[model samples]
Target chain A: MIDMFRRRFISVMVILLLIISGCNNRQETSSTNEAGDQVITIRAQTFGDEQTRIQNLEEAAKELNEQLKAENKKIQVKLETSSFDGSWEEYRRQFILAFKSKNEPDIFLTGHEDIAWLAKGDYILPLDELKDSEAYRDVYPTLWESVTWNGHIWGALQDTEARPIFYRKDVLKQLGWTDEEIESLPEKVKNGEFTVDDMTRVAKEAIDQGLVQWGILHRPVNGPEFHMIAKNFGAQLYDPKEDKLVFDKEAILESLRYFESLTQKEKVTPESMTSMEWKNVHQMMIDGKALFWYGGIWNIFNYMDQGAEFDYLMENFGFTLVPATEKGGTPMTLSHPIVHTVSSQTVHPDLVIRLLELVAKPEYQAKHSVETFHLPIHERGSEVEQFKNDEFLSQITYMLDYTTFLPNHADFNKYGDAYFNAIQSVEIGKKTPEEALKDMEVQIQNDLGDTIIIK
Target chain B: MKKWVLPYLMLTPFLLLVLLFFVTPVVITTIMAFTNMDYSMEWNFIGLQNFEKIVSDPNFSQIVFNTFIYVGFTLLINVFFALLLALLSSYYIPFEQSGLFFRALWMLPRITPPVVYVLLWLWIFDASEYGLLNTLTSFFFSNDPIAWLIDHPMTAIILVNGMVGASFGMIIFSSAIQSIPRDLFKAAQVDGASEWSVFKDIILPSIKWPIMFVTVWQLLSLLTSYEYILLLTDGGPVFESEVWPLYSYHKAFKNLEFGYGSALSLILVIIAILLTGVLLKLFKFNRMIQSSRIE
Candidate 1:
């Protein structure tokens, strides 16, 4: 009887302990050290290949701490940083889960396109107070438009890059193109003198002449590049008056038909191009096996990291805007600007904003741009010597004039997925462009419900 | 009441754990299926709307068909192939250590991390002249490089998942075969039973319970698993290799349609329960649990 009582007692104790642990919700926002100084630890996370997004914040923390000391404040800010170099979808999902769990970082860097979703989810703070600050005075007006959603500024623009159609000049030369023609291609594309059909014809000729094995290569995965192509074909992505995403069927059909012709009719691009790895795509471009690559300016740094000399890249490769869909049509590029957002769960909102302001300085932004090969968010960054002297950066900066942005609608991801799935279907010969577009319409309507305008 | 207290105390911890991990999530998911939760994560209930959307989805039929094919074929490979290997190593093979080595070789896929295993498959089937399969085809048959994953997504995923899944059944079946009394085999041989006859009447009967367990277990597992498929094909080239679980995940996490994803998951749970019930009846699980005739 005594042993039985002891067993019951132990079981009760285990249950009580578990319940106590489950109820423990201790969260340390700040701590005081033995010196009686308040040490504030601010955690920050940034996604994708731009490590400078968070690294620059760490540097800014130092400046902020010194400024605090100058103001006779008793606080020292310690910034802890983490980066995820994976797909943006996975990164955003992680952040959303973190927010739901109430353990989100004080600051996170993501695409400006996610502003609407993040703001709606209440995962980020509205930095409308910082909009009039002196630090943001020099930022480009267009970039400011990107970080604003629902009449409030949601995040601070970090950096942007132009998506360009990169081509191998040597391949064009081998196919009997003159140096003059090679140099004039960008100008021709910009002015709509060169159409997408003409680009396809050229790619097909290169393949026929055995100068290149493949005509054009694109990102194997879904990305802003597809939306850029859709916009080039005249798809209006958003209805601002209605505040709904637009599914422009005619324009999307044209874009899907274009991809179909490239894979099915032209026979220059492989049917399995969508399944290839990003590394393989880069290797094909570097090895000159492909004539044109629908890529981004950041790829220049990627190529350099892969051991291709900058001089070699300049001599061998050339970049131009995505050609017009038809004669006398407008040429275009896309800018997916990364933005730094303060989490709503943060205990140090003011300190986080101050650190972000320091990180946004022209000198620091320019340094990050020069190191990462991304374009600066403001005009003053152009005055920085490093950004001013970069030949590639100087050249690509003009493309931003014709640049477009993905819609800031919360349901834009669903629309983008439908668009990418249509492209994949057409390229794989699983469906005609018409069928793919019809299927996409159904998918979009099903996913977005009344949130999207199916035109 | 006093007599029941000790047993209840012993069972308390396990019941609490089940309540915490299993019951709570299921209850939450059932409730979420009726909500319109999206990126905002709000639980705004809209009854049957998500289910209506699922029924109206254009890819619904194709996704269902793909899941059927994936689960059906993978279950076959997981059960029969595993049984074959177990029989060869434990009963048929003359050399014991060689059999053990062969079993270990099959276990490698199960032991390797899913990412590394998928990476190896990717390297082998890459749609380029440099891929291992393409290289071999080029060298031996002088053939052009074939896009293996894109052209045959179902086959690639089924084989990858099946190879890993078979190892689990292999371990279980091998143990069951080894536990059979040695004297029965000797008696069968003395009675002039041929090797094939011995396998048919004696060995097969002895391992019936193991076979039944493996079949039902692998079927349930295959219905829910999509990691290998996600890593390999991502349910693409179209929805060719996409299964139900992957579709649920894409809807929930990828599209941020948490409520709809929950609805999809709830349907999958119902289907799994029905399938399990049918399988258990077909296997005569009640009979298997009854006392053996000899005892």
Candidate 2:
């Protein structure tokens, strides 16, 4: 019996060993056989779920290879691109893990918010020489602010979107506003004539009159929308001189107070609004249950997919920057731009930048802009016929002129996450603004230590 | 000599595996706990700093409290529902083979992929009239759809975790109940004893080992498990539902503070081991190692 058991165990162990070893044989073989031909394989990863970014990458490789073949350089560039459909948090988590393993992509596409961490970790390469290229000048100058860290240009702007405060003109009209008044709402907001308090009052009136089911709706989850609201209250999240995250106590308190008042005081928003899923928030606004929705320009495309026509949207909805906290204050919107960076481990930095140059061309950017509904990064690209004829793009492109990006700090996530929790506590009536603000300060201080300035 | 050498050689794989997968990681984690390793992967010796940070933070207390509530309630619900369902199906149910069908149905939530399972729960608790619970509640009670996750996040998470966990114990208890000798049950019944007495005397004692086995196994699992809770709530509504393991994950992966996260995980491992010891002592594990009562 002992002998039989031993034989069985030995065979089973051998089979398991073979099975486990087989799983590790996944590395691709290099094609180095041809006598005078060299292949530079570039592996790239994009956070975008859309295939357009990958297609653009492949096109750059194909274009580069064709030029190289014409020059008889005997070199070919192969670009392998992978796109992620998971949440941005998951993508960042996976990328960080891969970077730690030294198994990262040669070129990585990530949000500009990741620049501080990636640069600080020395995981990415700085593109100082690219500053002299036309490809660098092709993008809007202000967008470079997002990708700059420690006085170095760390990434190329891949794409951007401007978040807008969308309001239903029909709801305002139903509340007995004049047609001219509805038409001038964007300008009113632009000149700070329509302040946040004015928005709250209007939402309240709409609610009282039953013109809309909800007064004002924003994103349910933690996102850049909170930054837009904070900016309206004159809050700056980062101080460049000190190179530290700014926790301006008064500004954060005011912002938290405003958000709390929206739900608990003015009753413009649902108490459960903070807990809502992303889709329900979108569905409510598109279904016209909201008087004002703080959303992105991409929401127009989403509404179109939800069966709303452009004409109908133009007739019923008006878009503007989120209003300032007070009259005559500067009105601003938020822009979250994704950027492309070369890995420090990459061998072909020149070819990578060359690929980014192809991607930044006006024609290529316009194609991406039209397909993805993202704003054109190139200033002259907006003049292209495809971009010029798009009424939505034309109208909201002015937001680019006054947009603010999130602070590029490694600890920005910690700071923003704590602030989000503070606002959530206030929104849910679990804590007052005073209490929540104190809690937020303590949380940030604990998480970020003295790296953050709590003024 | 050949027989002895062959047996030792056959045992080598299991011993090597334990060293490679389990012991190696624990050793590395202990080493990492003392270093200020993060996203940069620079192993700077920062002795006691990570532990000091964890102990000094106020949120640490709340996180511990939340973890206890989550594990305690979830364990109670898992064991209660599992044992109750097993008893009902085995003895009370009128049909002969229907008990197996009911037990299989209970396993459905366990068999489903965790992500898909949590997503289905998200839809059910969606905070809008479109959600299933909201639609049903609005029709019956004339009340708006409640944000189940927000209003009762602890309950929502406990229920989500408990419902899936109950199936594990239910299957174990069912088999243990079926293993009770038919003669023992019939002899008790012939003595004019009530069904309750027969169950109390014959069924309960026979399945004590399975009950202990499932309890200890589930306690260890629930103490470390955070998947359903992570997916369902992501420890949201302002850290109200954040447990230790999920908090450690967020610290290490999301915040890129791997040193702090490693310290947190080491603490979790120690706590899990301590709890397992207490449970072993409580369950009289030595009694299990002794000869069987039937013999």
Candidate 3:
């Protein structure tokens, strides 16, 4: 009896110990140090190539701390920043999981498109109170639409980029195009004189003449660039009043047809192009093996990182908006703005907003923009010397005038997946454009139900 | 009660581990399947809507078909190739260390990180003119580069997965083959039996249990495994290579439909149970587990 009692007691104690250890004690967000200084630690995170997005917040904290010290306040602020270099899907999933667990950082950076989902989920705090703040007054009015959902602003714009179709000038030259014609391509695209079909024709001709090994190379994965191309083909992505995503069937069909022609009919893009590695695609472009790359302005940095000198890129490549789908139609570019959001679980919402405002200041924005090769969020950012003096920034800034944004809807990812799958099906000859479109319609309707408008 | 205490105490750690890792996740997943959980992470109960969605999914049939093909063909390669290697290394090879050397070489793919392993395959089958395969073809035949992955996604995934999977079976079968008594082989030689007849009559019956274990084990592994497929084809060039588990993963994590994803996974669990039962019965598991009549 004594031995049995001892065994039972030990088992109970072990179980109780496990339970105690498994339960976490929430840490105090702010603490007082021995020096009588109240220390506030704010954790921040950003994803992808946006390290400067969080680093700028760290810099802003330094300035804010100095001001507090000057004002004789007993408070000190410390910013804990992390930048993830993984894919956006993984990053967003981590943030969502962290939020669900009540362990999310005080502030984080994400694409503006995520604002709708985050706001709907109540995972983030609304910044409507800052709508009239002086810090946000100079922000470009167009970018404001991207962060607003359900009549409330949820985040501050961190940075923006324009997706451009980069072309190899040397390949065009080898195909008997004169320097004057090559230099005028962007202007022609901007004025709607050059069409997407014309671009395909040129690529095909280049492939036929053996001037380039392949005609066009695109990202081998699903991304916002496909949406930009679809927009050029006249796909209406969202309805603001209804707050619903639109399928725009005919326009999507045209987009699929375009990809099919490129990969199958024209034979300009490889059927295996969708399965290629990202690094190889960039290398192909850098080697001038491809006549065109449906890529982004940020790729300029990627090229430089891969040993392609800035001068060489400038001398060998030309970039323009995705050309018009038809003659006399508008060319389009896409800007996927990354934004700074405050978690709803934050203890210091006001301080977080203040830090974000400091980070949003024109000079800080210009510095980040110049270093990362992304465009500024406001006109004043261009006035800063770093942005003003950069030749590439100056040249690419005009593309923003024609830029479009992905719809800020919670289910936009579903639409994008269906859209991309259809493109793949068409490109690989598994289905015709009509069949792929039919499949896409069935898929979106089943997945999203009444949340989407199929036209 | 005193007698029972020690045994229960001894079993406590393993039972606690099972409760923590296995039971908790299964319970949570089962509960989640009934809720309309999404990126919002809300627990609003929605009953069978998720299961209904799975049944109605257009890709459901195609994914199921892909899963069967992947498991079936990969299992064939894994089991047969492993049996061949085990027999050769343990029985036929003149020098044992050389056989061990070849076995160790085969084990490299199993030990390499999945990402690195998949990357090597990607380089080998790259569609571009500069890919390793393409470089060789261009050098020897002066032919244009062929798109190995795009043209034949299923074959690539099967071979990649099979190569890694075969090593596991080889290890199990080799040990089993090595354990068979030398008296059986010497007896067969004294009876003037040919090597092929001896293999058929002695070796085949000696390792029946291991063969059955490998088949059932590999079938279950293949049914659930998707990391290699995820890295290699990501179920694409279209849905030509998509499997059920990958589809479930893409739905839950990629598409952020947690509830629906849970439902898909729950269905997979059910299918796995049924298939496991059938496999065990087909392999005569009860008979194999029974004590030998000779003993």
Would you estimate the TM-scores of all the predictions? Answer: 0.95, 0.95, 0.96
Q: Per-residue lDDT tens digits of candidate 3, residues A1-455?
A: 65876777687878878876655433467888787889999999988765678678878999888888898889889888888887777988999877765667889889999999998888899999777888778777788888988889998888998988999999999889899999999999988999988999999999889888889888888899899888988889999788899999999998899999999999999887887777788999999989999999989999999899999999999999899988988898899999989999898888888888888888888988988999998889988998999988888888888888999899899999999899888888889999999999999999999999988
How well is each residue in A308-350 modelled by candidate 1, as lDDT tens digits?
8999999999989999988878888999998989998898899
Q: TM-score (chain B) for model 2?
A: 0.95
Pairs of colliding residues, candidate 3: none
| Residue range B155-181, candidate 3, lDDT tens digits | 999999999999999988888888888
Please list the residue runs of candidate 2 whose C-alpha ends up more than 4 Å from where it truly belongs after superposition.
A1-36, A305-311, B293-295
Model 3 residue runs over 4 Å out of place are A1-25, B293-295
Q: TM-score (0 to 1) for chain A, all models? A: 0.93, 0.92, 0.94
Estimate the lDDT of model 1. Answer: 0.88
Q: What lDDT does the true structure give each of the candidates?
A: 0.88, 0.85, 0.88
Share of the reference A-B contacts seen in candidate 2: 0.62
Chain B TM-scores across candidates? 0.97, 0.95, 0.96
What is each candidate's DockQ, to 2 decimals?
Answer: 0.59, 0.48, 0.67
Provide the lowest-lDDT 10-residue window in model 2 chain A. A24-33
Top model by lDDT, which number?
Answer: 3
Chain A TM-score (model 1): 0.93
